[model samples]
Target: MGRDRANIRVDLWADGDWRGLSMGAQHLYQQILTHPTLNYAGVADWRPGRLAALTKDRTAADVQRDACELTEAHFIHADDTTEEVLVRSFARHDGVIRHPRLHVTMANDFAGIASTDIKEFFAFEIQKLNQEQPELALWNHPKVQTILKAKARDMKEVTQRVRQEEAMTFGSATAKPMAKDPNSVSMRTATATATSSKEDIPSSEISDEIPRPDVDELLDLLDSCLLANGTRKPSRNKKNREAARLLLDRDGYKVEQVAWMIRWATADEFWRANILSMSKLREKFDQLKAKAGVATKTPSAGFHGEIDVEAVLGRDVWTPGTPPEGLDVAGEIAWKKEQRNIHNAERLAEAKQKLGIS
Candidate 1:
């Protein structure tokens, strides 16, 4: 319920549920999972008007439809009569709960709900857990055991209907139970997160060869490059992280390619002025590549009237009508000398060829 821990873990299970959901539904589901108060309890008052106040894009009807989809997918449970919604798997954890007290407190809160459907659903989940996870301490809790026994008949009847509904909706009675080891589930989930390797990434039938950048290293490199090129370092935020993730993880840009582009853009007088951030860098990446292609190829001999000192020095070493920055002066002089030497050597070779020297 605290804003200090607003972020929530979005496991890879979402991929399966996403298939039948509309974009609006997925967004609403995320809102439910991540909303500060709702995230902690995983239960919310399902008043349509109340929910509509929180979701501007969705009407009350849309909210109802989305909630139904989530229920059909077994992502959540909603009782229209009581207006209480519950995320079915919210209390389920693959591993030992990090904070048992907090998790226990939250579970207790849900257990106290005054709705029959909600109580039955929670009791059924507890029974399922007891069967699948006999080692878990929840099964040993006297109160939890009592609740399961007390609701035994209702839980059995409700669970059977829920399974039937699931089969009718999804062609399956229930999602495959997760393995006991949280690590196994985490390993599978890893494939879906930004850090996934080539093998983990799903293909269309099913996913790229470009090595994903180490996110930390990539961000550090961005800052270093910006600082070296005299740009102020910007604070890292969600938008910046997203941009970098898209370019490196999703867009298949190599880390080196990103570094090269960042270097090139920040040194190009015109581009340096425009591409001052990672978002801008991602936006102009193709243009930077095209420009780099032109620069690296170098004009064929005698094909140019004006020398592009920028191309020679890999930076804007000469600005029109003014002396270049002192930082570039040394590089400019060295580049010009190298160019003259190459030009002279070429002429000498041509002369020797004319004179029939082997």
Candidate 2:
């Protein structure tokens, strides 16, 4: 049986995650919670089009965008591969562990999940909850272990720790990386590639020489580019490495040229999400180069002298660091001034607090 009701606290409005969301996103979250198809495991059919139809003015694209915002906020998880939406904390919040009989339904619902990514993420959430609330002792339950075992979407079903980790590394071709790896500079790119099934560059294409740190920066640059756009980071393990290698070794693009192209493609509103991997970057390099040339030579004019900076730079979350390639003198000055203003604001707040001002 599906969820008859979900436990939504009245104080939900005061929650940090909830308070930070836009009104549309907040409404979408509520609608999902009360959705008829939401199962015992808190997974609901990912039908944004249908959800959109429920409201008078909401469009499918609006729903999709709000869902993306929610996913990025870590309050929920959406996997297009499985076409499923998961309320990440639902298992704990549902109080299922308090009722032993609910285990059967929870198991059945979890087993029904087609996405291994969701399964892994949900299982981690449950284990984490158990750790924080030892009284739950979730794993100690006999059926709990069997229930949380990730059923492979591609290969044989596995519950072994080794197999689970292996599945995580190479399970879904299009799966987003589960965790950030600290050891690698381009962690997201490496993880995404390691798990991908489509090998654009063959094993034979792999060079005998390890990529230099400078070469690897190409991969890192792609990761940063995506992050700057607030886009989901694709693992860069193979697709990034081989594509970058080919660009340098075979296609004959210099490191600086490739780096500039990386920023160029990623800075475009349309291309940033599309050109995820280094392989994809290589595929679209020429087109990107051509378009970038046009944009640079003639900055798109806005009303009067004002320039639409966003048109030039994709909605990247710019930070205090190396400015993106192709940023004009005016743009650089604006960025620097914004940073200085932020610093001044902080200083003002500190002084006010020290002076016992409200």
Candidate 3:
């Protein structure tokens, strides 16, 4: 039997794949995630008969079909010969780094509950992962190694349990280790900051235009708009801060305006998928503004209702007959027709103003 997991963090943005899943497959995925056997190892028996019992009114065949669906969707991996399944992203989803001891217990528990074939498969898988690229090997994960280290410490201090508790790695608040880039300066903070005294933090990453909380607020907005990869600050600090500086100081955009742009871009179907980072946002700001239907009108350039159609649309708007050089005949005709409409509208507006019409 496996241990209980009280709750699992569900990242709604990352799990957009769930929306397209069949109801049966969705149900099966949920059952597997919450199964008692899905402990620290995140591997469990893929026995259709056993899982079928959990799915109300569903047959073994149905469970099998849904299992296939899950496998195809990269949600779970199952071996036909061994009848064992491993949740691919389980360790990541469960924050395994924070619960190293639990993983050790689950790996140990697997020997008793799992069949011989399943156990053999897991061993083989771990061995292959080790021989090929041990860094990515499931058993050799940092968390697992951390657990082994803690266990060794415990055995050494068997007679001093209180001391063991104090020295334990998994459950201690002060001892909790955060993932960090080895090259980057490590600055563990409960909240985001605009400036850092650390030598590793480049001057470019810091911005004086926006306060620390404001930068954090923009980060929060980006996190909501973007999918986070198991980190508190989702966007790269240097890129994000640089983009913010451009928006706030160079471009002369208000904080509220930048905030609105974040909201609008994230909410837009096209822009949402495109604006993954603040740097990308700053780069495509003009295009996004145009996409948001910001077509500003300009004063008439010529006396004969002639207008700079390009200026009005913020881009080249081919007018009838006089299309920009090298435009094809058909494109010229299209532009001419569109230009006629604009000319007529501009003329009407002029007439109204001359007559003092409201």
- Tens digit per residue, CA lDDT, model 1, 1-358: 2222433455654666565666766776777766554533456545544565686654443565566455545666655434456666655642312345554545455454645666666667656766776776655555556655846223334434544432343234222221111111111111122222222222331113444346556677878876785556654643355567677766797676676667666666445544545655665566666554433432232112112234333343332232245423234434555664665455444544554544
lDDT of 1: 0.50
Task: Report the lDDT of model 2 for residue 53.
Answer: 79
CA deviation > 4 Å runs, candidate 3: 109-358
TM-score of each: 0.39, 0.45, 0.32
Candidate RMSDs in order:
25.4, 19.3, 21.5
What is the Cα-based lDDT of residue 114 in candidate 2?
A: 63
What is candidate 2's TM-score against the reference? Answer: 0.45
State each model's CA lDDT, in order.
0.50, 0.59, 0.49
Model 3: weakest 10-residue lDDT segment is 182-191
Tell me which of candidates 1 and 3 scores higher on TM-score: 1
Residue pairs clashing, model 2: 189-235, 189-236, 189-237, 190-236, 190-237, 192-235, 193-235, 228-317
TM-score, predicted candidate 1 vs. hidden true structure: 0.39
* lDDT of candidate 1 at residue 171, scale 0 to 100: 39
TM-score of 3: 0.32
The true-versus-predicted C-alpha distance at residue 41 of model 1, in Å, is 5.7
